[model samples]
Target: MSMYVRVKRQDQTVFLRAEASDTFRTVKVALGDILSLVLDDIKLYGKDKETVLEDEGTLGGFEIGNDDVIFWGQRMDGSTFEPASGN
Candidate 1:
């Protein structure tokens, strides 16, 4: 089974395809050697939600299902506490 993670940033969006068995937690591990952001610094959410700073565990437990997606990036507002959509 293959899964894809779509990483979005202010300047770009990238799709990473990987095996479903890979549990390399954290967006930093998923986007390795690309942009430089620590796991704690990476702000990730679904297409419809937001998460707290130390919430990587729950984020990781949910596998990206077949064709399922994960959205991750640096916060444009300069604060991890801010929402991505600016609502």
Candidate 2:
């Protein structure tokens, strides 16, 4: 089934239509396409903003549901950077 997910990077947000079976890498590629960034530079976080979603993991495996928020940030120098808080 298809579901919507809210992907956020600081104050910027994008809603992506995805399927439970879709891999996190797929989501990253889509986000990269929209943001004009390299897919390898994108990193996705869970709702808690702590857990790093694995590229091979599926949305359903992460328990991501419709309207769920996914935090994203750019990877720099092989280090993960946290996205600025929207608040």
Measured by TM-score, the strongest candidate is 2
Show how many residue pairs clash in every candidate, following the order shown. Answer: 0, 0
What tens-digit string does per-residue lDDT give for candidate 2 at 1-87?
789999988888999999999999999999999989998888888888878898999999989999998888787567766553442
- Reference-based lDDT, each prediction: 0.53, 0.87
| Candidate 2 TM-score, C-alpha based | 0.89
Q: What is the Å distance of residue 59 in model 1 from its true position?
A: 7.5
lDDT of 1 by residue, 1-87 (tens): 556666554446767776655543544566755666565556665645454323434333564555555555555455644344321
Give me the runs in candidate 2 sitting further than 4 Å from their true place. Answer: 77-80
TM-score, every prediction = 0.54, 0.89
